[model samples]
Target: MPVEWVIDQIKAPDQSGAFSYASGAAPFCEIRLWPNRSLPARGFVFFIAATAVMLALPLIAVLGSPVWWGLLPFILGTLALTWFLLRKSYRDGAMEERLKLWSDRIEVTRIEPNQPETSWSANPYWLRLALHPNAGPVENYITLRGEDREIELGAFLSPDERTDLYNALESRLIAVQARK
Candidate 1:
């Protein structure tokens, strides 16, 4: 799963009554989520190498002929285009969402490649998780409704993952509320 529990520790305040993590007290939870990357860096290299080999295999028969020169530019262009597209995909997949929960507040921050970061937060008491099975843009869509706005959560996740996240968020919200 791409969902990770970045911080799930409960640390007591220092002697002066200050928390060590962010601007919150003890018992804070932070969750980081991202879309799955099916291709790793090594896999990317292997794929490009295999593609180049395959593309070159057909040119071997024409190695010493004028036809090889005529087709070489097209083959190189195709390989370059493929590399460019895959690199773009990797960049697009760099998006991530971080959700932080405190005893009194909950915040969700989204960071996407080449885009401004967006954040939403509200008191845990007033937050609500809404799960739409079929009516949302995606099946099993999850959204958090705050006092003033509603923001989507894990929209890039699969339907099953979104359902699991909804349940997990509900339980976490309950736990946060109980700590008060």
Candidate 2:
């Protein structure tokens, strides 16, 4: 679940009964919906190291062979490409969609790698969580609709994850509406 959603209750005397959902990357000062990374940095390093060692083994026997010159670039290029992609993935891993739901309003904020934060808001009473199992660019795409706007919720999540998110959001919104 690289995309995550969490609900928290506001506990201050003035804001009693207010509910918040920190989805994506909201500051932990409250709660946040954040990414559940499938690969850790350490694991990535270990895997790359193992791969490099394995790839180097056969090449060691071919050292100084005329073919080695041609093979060397391909080997180094492949490793370099792998390292670049892995580093890029790690760099983008911090991207998140933060959704905050309170009694009166629902706000969604997105933070992407090296990008400015973008946000959308709607009244909780009028907000809708929609799941299009066959529509959009991906399967089980999820979107949120407000009175005058609509936005995708978790495009980074897998289809199964989007389904889970849809169910949780449907329930949470209903609960918040009821309490309001």
Instruction: Find the candidate with the highest lDDT and give its number.
Output: 1
Off by over 4 Å in 1: 9-23
**What TM-score should be assigned to candidate 1?**
0.89
Give a tens-digit lDDT track for model 1, residues 100-132: 887667889999999999988888778888999
- Which runs of model 2 end up more than 4 angstroms from their true locations? 3-6, 9-31, 34-36
State the lDDT of candidate 2 residue by residue for 99-129, as single tens digits: 7767567878888889999988888888878
The alpha-carbon lDDT assigned to residue 175 of candidate 2 equals 64
| Cα misplacement distance, residue 172 of candidate 2 (Å) | 1.6
